[model samples]
Target: MDILDILLSASFWAAAIRIASPLIFATLGELICERAGVLNLGIEGIMVAGAFSGWIAVWAGLPLWGGVAVAMLTGMAFGLLHATLSVPFGLSQHVVGIGLTLLATSLTFYTYRVVLPEVSSPPKIEAFQPYEIPLLADLPLIGPALFSQTPLTYAAFLLAAICAYTLYRTPVGLAVRAAGENPSAVAAQGLSVTAIRMGAVITGSGFMAVGGAFLTLSAFDSFFFDMVNGRGWICIALVVFGAWRPGKAVLGAILFAAFDALQIRLQQTAIGALVPYQLFLMLPYILSILALVVMSRRAEVPAALMVPFNKGER
Candidate 1:
């Protein structure tokens, strides 16, 4: 295809959507938890666990939707674990999160080895099909590229919108913000700070898990070692970059995803064959660090973020 043809191709946008979906999901998830004053460093582990769990569900003859469900449930479980350790026990969230990541890494490897002893090549499955909007898909340049995408991609966008609304527009949202800002004040007002934060943590984890499932079930249709590959950590940085706002986080995710998509495209071109592929692979990390440095000046983190709230205080 010519330059114009390739630029306008459905495939280019498809690649962008594919790259954006997981990041959008994960970043929005982190937004939810972080907005509620909890930092989940275990996100990497939770995502890895979700990827393995979702793949196992598919391998067990469950539908992709079923796998998604399993992944979400697994995420909720991890969220609860993080909450229990950090909130009630008053432990450092970073330490708990890191421990959880180490645990998840071990669990994923153990399960994979046990379930697929002879499988040298990673097992693959049928990925989810993209949904095309009737009239929108037929539009000019950006139509097919943007309108025709997988259900998870659409869901990622929808989740971003919904999270932004709920976090800023709803009563529960107010409570969540209060819990994150001043749990004692919220408690004096007869609201249960613990409950609100716990709910946020669990729900946030579910979102992250869905992102992981998107990677395994929709994007690749297979599980590989460290398949999440620090995308979970990237999500954390995106949350910071977005200043704990879901809409901004989604925008950040898409930006990062676009860079990633560009890297992949470069890898497949003639120029890609001439250069060292690892250099291209490093672009995402370098860009992420640069983005983080730039965005930090603008970020507005919650006042109580990363601080354990004592139930008996005040």
Candidate 2:
């Protein structure tokens, strides 16, 4: 089919939503971190650790949700390490984040080898099944695309809504935003900027881990090395694309996912025969870069983002 036909196809949209699910989770997690003035670059390794932890937990016979919990807790542990050095100790956020990534990635690989030393291939497990909401799934184009997705996909969207509400509508949300924008003001009001930043990093990291779990427990049945494949980095950019707002970040994720879905479909059409496969592979990133450039031009970053705050210091 042609490009226009492919764009209109319900199946294509469904694929886009599925592809966007993991991104939605990670982007929201990153958004939360940045909103609280911390840049957790450990996201990539955190996602890798999360994917492995969740899969291994399930392989060890925990229920699917239990595996998800394991993954989230694993991520939070790494996040705590990140927070301890960067928040209270006032270390370089960049160095701490990168160090955490390397540490998490290496630990995950070591654990995998130790657990399955003799196994040549990764094992598979039963994964989550799609759940279709009755009436909503019956709709024409929007139904299958939105309503017919795995439980994790639905949870991703729900979490986005919750993030938006918490960030804009609640007192705690105000404190979090204040911590990122003007820590002095937060301190004047008797809130602990260090505590707020640390909590945000830990909570955000948990969400990021759940994103990784989505891959093993929902998108696929088995885990493999490099399965996360830099999606974590993409999530960082998506936060910028969405200007750190949960709602906008979600849209950015969906837009990127659509471009990705389109590229895959185009590779199957007559155009795939005319162009190199590498070009198709690059299509999503190229388009996403252009979109990011346009959208980020007007994005207003939090004033205190990445600025280390020490109590009683201006």
Candidate 3:
């Protein structure tokens, strides 16, 4: 009946985790790209491409896991295209990112239409169901919400830990940071700046694809136009708010998803009768923008971000 009732509901938290799953994937992918200083604005297109390709693969008789793989590969291919243009060829990062976004988005829509009937009813696939951990799922307030989830949800958390460890505890991570902040210095140290950057792009793009696949394969079972619904853009914004850290990004994703879940529930409740529910829907984005403005100056962006690394010159 009130804000406390909404916040304390276990079902509400459960819904939030479910909604945040795909966002966790997308935000991590964006964090990786930005950490590498690539500014891969093609993130939205990549998510769309993965969602469509993964759905098509499922419809074509591949296993659900296989569909996820297909989505990642599709995203990786786009990542390579982006890396080739911006990393090795020294194209403008902004131009390359936008071009790739347009290319990927157009190609995905066109191919889907060409292959399948572009009718009103979109095709559907079997979606992943929740797997409740025995003891953990039975816990008081947090149990059902945090413990019972699809494998993809669990994987998102695992990924957050893996990314944190990789970025902060490994030599490869240092090189990744160096490539983004000072590629010239990295090149001077005899490391191939191109290779490091390309690796980041490919890996980051794969994560983006996984995010998209989560939508089609786990969150929802059907594929349609605009299924991504600007979550990719939200992920980009969250990266800035998260300060480019994987753990912080995960926190940001979960927070945004909480608002998202709340807004959906609020719209369906009697609360909508008393107030404009659409305002609730804007909570996550509005919060993100405010967080960015308030914290952007304090955020530590890569020093050489968006600047092409010309090895022979400066």
Q: How high a TM-score does candidate 2 get? A: 0.98
Which segments of candidate 2 are over 4 A away from where they belong? none
C-alpha RMSD between model 3 and the true structure: 1.5
lDDT of 2: 0.93
Give all TM-scores, in the order shown.
Answer: 0.91, 0.98, 0.96
Better of 2 and 3 by lDDT: 2
User: lDDT per prediction?
Assistant: 0.83, 0.93, 0.87
Root-mean-square deviation per candidate: 2.3, 0.8, 1.5
- List model 1 lDDT by residue over 122-197, tens digit each: 8787778888888998888567777888887888888888988888899999888888888888888987777888
lDDT of 1 at 171: 95
Give the lowest summed-lDDT range of ten residues in model 3.
Answer: 288-297
- lDDT score of residue 140 within candidate 2: 97
Best by TM-score: 2
* Tens digits of lDDT, candidate 3, 1-314: 56678889998999999988988887888788778778888888999999989989998999988998999999999999988998889899888887887898899989988988556787788888899989999999899899989988999999999999998899898888888898888998999998999889888988898899899999999887788988888888888888888888888888888887777777767777888867987877887777678767788999878888878985
User: lDDT winner among the candidates?
Assistant: 2
lDDT of 2 by residue, 1-314 (tens): 89999999999999999999989988998899899999999999899999999999999999999999999999999989998999999899899989998999999999999999988789998998999999999999989999999999999999999999999999888999999999999999999999999999999999999899899999999888889999999999999999889998999999999999999999999989999999998988898899999999999898899999999986
